[model samples]
Target: MLNEEKILAILRLQKCKAVGDILAKKLIVHVGDVVQIFREKTSHLSKINGIGKHVLKHLFTKENITLAQQELRYIQDNAISYSYFLEDKYPQNLQHCVDSPILLFEDGAIDFSNKKIISIVGTRNMSSYGRDFCTKLITDLAPHNPIIVSGFAYGVDICAHKVAVQNNLQTIAVLAHGFEQIYPKVHKKYMQQVNENGGFLTEFWHNEMPLRENFLKRNRIVAGISNATIIIESAEKGGSLVTADIANSYDKDVFAVPGRTTDLYSKGCNNLIKNNSAFLLNSAKEIVNMLNWDLKATPKIIQKQLFLDLNENEQKIHDFLHDKGKQILDVISLECNIPMYKLASILLQMELKGVSKPLPGKMFELI
Candidate 1:
């Protein structure tokens, strides 16, 4: 009963998720009329006023009818979440986007409740300063546990993600294609780590290619998802500026980390700042402090309080290890739900106190 013709007809619509769904629902509503028309009861529905030839042509076609059923089955089985404009879970701020995706495939725990989210974007081909700044910035802001968002591109995006992973924060990559394939296959290992530690999200459906247009289109989602956007380092041209502009259009804050004015990589950021289009951010702490993110956690268990009492930020850290036992840094971040940098420092203090043990692969256990 799958309508292969209908499927092909729908596909011909091109990027028609929302549109096709609407049209399909309409067809269902007129099923009686459609059956009659197909059975020759109405002598060619095209003759009926308001029944356009195009719609009638497709509607009566046996191929389209079969394809329609197939598409319906595919949609139902995939369990894909469509974030239509009317959906309750759809982000309110992103509803007005011109290039907004009609559907999104989400994986992992996504919390839009976080009031403070800043996009850490930069050039794919980054320099030493960009790398060092990103690491230090993310580490410093680990306490606030800002949800890190970025394109899972080469260089800066992955660097930021690596730091975020190391710090134990939730990071989401907005892919240029569907979730079926990952761009820059080299990051497959890192992406797996992201899924376990954070998650990867996308607007394109499964099997979509990482086309150039998709990347440009996906940048808007990156800007839309966050409250602010930051550019670390970019040449005078590249996709980073595109994200910054989208952020501005969305009325979201745009910030740029200043680099040496003379540096080639700094040109895009410098121009953004010079144009007064973006705030000049020197460090992650500034972004954290500016956003007023609530990162400090209140330990509820008696053991946590007792452990805190036993040591200052340092000794109390040992209590986590001694009591909870050894865990990989990533595992601890997830289980403890704490940022990686803070977890590491807390763990380091325990190690120095001789109350904790360090294992291979950056794991720690109680001594």
Candidate 2:
């Protein structure tokens, strides 16, 4: 646990306009401690990478310190809980992301001991197909006792949370705003149930509003906190796709449920699958299989291939990936001497043939 001074210092840094999570971390590492950052001379601090006069101008402002003090009082009075990025209790998966928040506010009984967390996200204007798929997917995965995470907005987010609650599975609502107010107010009704099931998490302060950018910022947490992200449904463009892209960036597996060619919502999922950004999800089994989740009582399904065939390029890529483990597309191309444009199609073919799987961060590994 952080002491009062350190916590206050963190709050102050968080309030600084020039500092983001990445820069904050750099500052802390450079200064040797959170408190030292505030105590250190501006001249010495500026010497560190990414720290400059512009950032220091806002960093030591009286206004930021005053605001931090006020927020600290509120946290103390209300017993608001938080986790610092350096703490052991911080989300493990999120810790891997370069831009994850330096601090997180949380409520209820959120636990990450299970390790089987999966985020399900999609359009706020959730279609019936999306709803049905979200419900069934959680229900089927319930036996494995995975935590379901979503944005807690309407449509797919709330639906996933509700279904997870019904299935007695832990569900996390990663909020875009502060705990002081809930967006869409209608979701307030389900707050208690969600708390009982899992909990709410946010990086925003107590009074922060649910601004448009916060939702986009919150997507990284939803994507990073999970082992894999499932896009139940999406439009031609949506926040869920953003989450999928972020998850891909984090090297996490992404799954997209397919819909008809003409369906507006399925277009996003179809595009993700077609471009090999996401695996074509048919059922819970695909997730279970890809993530290598073990069932408590079910017999394991195994498909043995007696003969595996690969052409010259596929064989070279496969051999390289198999020997070296996960490799990004560019590195693979360089090592295999394949042109990038043509390599993409080769990798997609490999993915379809069950020879390899695409990971976030443009990486591939043999399956």
Top candidate on TM-score is: 2
Candidate 1, residue 69: the lDDT equals 60
Per-model tally of clashing residue pairs: 11, 2
Position 303, candidate 2: lDDT = 62
Q: 72-134, model 2: which lDDT tens digit per residue?
A: 999999998899876668887786576889899999999899989999999888899889988
lDDT of 2: 0.88
Cα shift from native, residue 54, model 1 (Å): 10
User: For residue 27, what is the lDDT in candidate 1?
Assistant: 32
Over 4 Å off, model 2: 295-367
> What TM-score against the true fold does each predicted structure earn?
0.63, 0.81
- The sequence of per-residue lDDT tens digits that candidate 1 reaches over residues 242-331 is 999989886678989888879999999999999998999897766866665645656855433333333454554454555555544543
Q: Who wins the lDDT comparison?
A: 2
Q: Count steric clashes of candidate 2.
A: 2
